[model samples]
Target: TGKAYELDFNQIALDPVTGEEQGRRMWGEVSLSRENLMPFLYKLHYSMHIPEGFGIELGILLFGIVAIVWTLDCFIALWLSFPAWRGWRKSFAFRWKQGGYKLNFDLHRSGGVWIWGLLLILAVTSVSMNLNVQVTRPLVELFSPLTPSPFASRTPVSLDEQKFPGISRDEAVSLAAAEATRLGLEKPAGGVFYSPEFDVYGVGFYTAENDHGDGGLGNPWLYLDGQNGALAGTQIPGTGSAGDIFMQAQFPLHSGRILGMPGRILVSLLGLAVAMLSLTGIVIWAKKRRSRVLSDQRRRHAEPEMQAVS
Candidate 1:
């Protein structure tokens, strides 16, 4: 299947070699294909190769918890960075002249302090992405009203009970295109997606090059009823309530695509910084622990000497 097809998800089943419409394939069959390396990696990043079983997505839940912990740790680390108000500058200063332990400590503490806001954003957005329904939506709703998500608002049917769309994919796209034009959106319909669980068709509008809707709140998506092809809901980025917009920004912010290429570069560097900080932290802990153990051993040896002398 070296032949490239259109970006429409509607034709996901189209055999590129034979030019025949094949039935829908499983996610692994498509995502794990030779041509879909990025998609496979993206899936691995969030899901960590965990398969869904027993009505639980363990990978998502575990990552969500980790994000929550990371979010709280950010605040704790910030507080620890400023132990004394007068010497607070030390927290942000790197001891470049003194290498080894001092430099490691400085990198771990100062590096984190320098990019604390970005770290917090990453942590919080991670939670939003991993646990939108379980945690983020509830928390956002506490402060601001959120427009109900079409996928979440509707009742989900089991795979066995899933109903086929009454309207064709082309019909759904046409309805979505009409809605996009009505709203004065200029971007063409870039992709079409169907949710079997919710029985909804989501039509995304953007340029081919900007499929992810990089830069500024991402792209607009229209959710249509699969049965009637009627507009069910709309997600026009940057055009909603405070809570709604915040919810929409989660994926873009998490992936650092909100600022486009520059943001992606920054996020990649930040990832390295995070890794460095974690390694330095472990080194610091090990050094301290070793020191404590040596001190305790010396004290024990001295106690025996003191007893002998007595």
Candidate 2:
């Protein structure tokens, strides 16, 4: 960061003749280009050893999940409504006698039983979406650049002072991203702060949420080991592309977490279903218990008098 100044994209940034801004936008433009994208991705995934079309397949899988999640939603709704259907099995469930409405009775009670397990499975699996990916994926791709957040064995990481003597904001950001790739850091994201007075480069990495801070489950950042080409002691969680601070941030934006925004709204609806189902299930179970106890008491009272007389 530097003193705020207005910049013209067309003149200062895009124009070939503009010397200062040309290099700046060059990184920005290619930040997502086919030429440099894969390595930039490698820096994040930490590897690139997958089958030829694995990345494209992964994209397909991500798309496939949308349909899967939607299907899960329909099942969840069916499951939650099961208790109301089960009420039909009761003598006066649904405010009428199941004895008289046999077809209606089966519709409520049996239909719900069929979908209940399926709904529960979907809910649990959906929550595991990110967790499963996080816990297992990066390690699997430790040697594959296609994976997110894989670290390299010989990455330059150091804890020395005076390493980044003349490094500025841009240099610091580049070094952090480069080291992250070399060292196999996963899904790195952060901002760059520059100061001529400090004459040192500080590149902070974290989640897009801006929650990644020093030792706070925050994004890991590194102060350039100015003396040597290594990262200093700062490990924020998550990684993004290398090249430019502001530009690489876009991919992270697409990840639905720059704002700590929820991944998808599917889970939100699922949560509502869970709450409703839980409450209705408890009520139905309670009602069934009371009915069974009453019936037993009535039977015992009816048979006792005759036995005593005999």
Candidate 3:
């Protein structure tokens, strides 16, 4: 039901030099050469294609809850499937001699047991992101230092605040760059965004000097006051509070970017495994139902013959 951002021709336009901007045929008309499925997948995964905004929100909330509950169920199933010390070796092996149903059952059970940890991590993180549950914040806070407080510059300005003359974006960027070097941020400056809500310029950059230098999460950020080139604070991932690190890790982990290419491949394969498990489960149920129906039919036919003989 959802469409890609690139396909929203009404809201977007193409420029010869800078493509895809807000306007209609400013420089030249743009056309799609081929179909792109990334946007479709994104919308489907997030359940954002619902007719109305409220519907989309409701769908995400319900989905997050279901995922979390299902994750817990998977954990229970894995625990129940655990074999004794003597059976540990056999538990990992699949019996090829078994029939289709038995094999399916074993695959479902064994796969669940093997990948349950990853599934749980993904599920919990999904809940935290979609549901906005601060599960990690409290745990991290207990063990780590406090995160920097939000920007609170008392100096106020009118809504029509001038962008120039005070502190240019370039100045803010330079300060951020210097700060990054001092903090030993290995990655180059990611990018910068202007935040009107907080009247500050935010710069995002990555570093490989922290607890989770695996690059699975997003880069840390540096916040500077828009009015003047004053350093508000920096959210360096490597040196952040526990809560900050946890929050930072969510996006990368969710998208499989935290662990690089290998992590992405692993997550993709796990997704396929989940799909297979669901299909096999449905197949098993259907076969059982069909067998029950045949048994009932045979019993009804035999009942009349037995009565006549009696």
Candidate 4:
């Protein structure tokens, strides 16, 4: 049928209008397609394509640990960049006149010094993204209050035990729209999503064009209970405790979407700079290792000669 329908994890598609089976598509068949490239890359960034097992996402945990290490490394790098107060300006200057290894060293140290703040922001936000419940949320809550997360509040059921919602997606969207209006929100209902595990429906407030939430603190979302359509929680960005606002700003700040197209462009360039710094850092390390090895070899040869002379 050409009519609208909702697909479940079991590969069953049901028409909300008729409450009848429409058709079913294999889950992998639909997901593993060319159109899903962006979504695949997005997941890869945070999860590294690791499969979930034993109720733990190993990929996410691994990257979260990496982010924590990277955050600490940023501060250490900054300190190492400035060796003395007498010539602190050297940390920010590039040795453009002397190219090759000197330039590479300068790029690694000076380039890092120039954009150290941005790099730190990215590292910290990566941790927040991967370890929100485990680390970020708890840390944020220590200083400021946070409304309970709807996803965390509910225990997720197994796929076989998934429950279908009593109200339709349309009804949930309407309820959310009404709530948005009552709360003086200006945006229209953009989309609706159902969580089979948690049995909750979330209606996002935004336009189709702004679905990615390019500007500001991103869009607001209303979550409702599946069984009775009761309001479960609301995430109206820019309106919450200090910690709540900080948490809301994480993705926008990390992706540089807070500044819209210009922000995205800057972030793209920043990524290139980071790659360059890593390459230069490796080159510097290799050259030093080679010199150290040669010095050790010479020292060993001289030690035998000195013993014989003595």
Candidate 1 lDDT over 250-272, as tens digits, reads 98888889999999899999999
- Which numbered prediction scores highest in lDDT against the true structure? 4
Of models 2 and 3, which has the larger TM-score?
Answer: 3
lDDT of 2 at 266: 40
Which stretches of model 4 miss by more than 4 angstroms? Answer: 1-33
**Tens-digit per-residue lDDT, 112-226, candidate 3:** 7677778777887777776653344455567775565445334444435533336777888898889878878767666677665567888777443532334446566778877
User: Model 3, residue 6: what's the lDDT?
Assistant: 40
Model 3 lowest lDDT segment of ten:
25-34
Tell me the tens digit of each residue's lDDT in model 2 across 77-147.
55555546556444223424444334343334443444455455453343334233443234334543332
Which regions of candidate 3 fall more than 4 Å away from where they truly are? 1-36, 51-56, 80-90, 133-168, 196-200, 206-217, 226-233, 291-310
**TM-score for every candidate vs. truth?**
0.90, 0.32, 0.68, 0.90
Model 3's TM-score against the true structure: 0.68
Residue 225 lDDT, candidate 4, scale 0-100: 96
Q: What value does the lDDT take at residue 216 in candidate 2?
A: 21
**Backbone clash count, each prediction separately:** 0, 32, 1, 0
lDDT, candidate 3, residue 36?
A: 32
The alpha-carbon RMSD values of the candidates against the true structure, listed in the order shown, are 5.2, 17.8, 7.2, 4.8
lDDT of 4 by residue, 182-288 (tens): 99989999978999899999999998899879999999999999988999999998998999999999999999999999999999999999999999999999999
Q: List lDDT for all candidates, in order.
A: 0.88, 0.46, 0.67, 0.90
Model 2 scores a C-alpha lDDT of 0.46
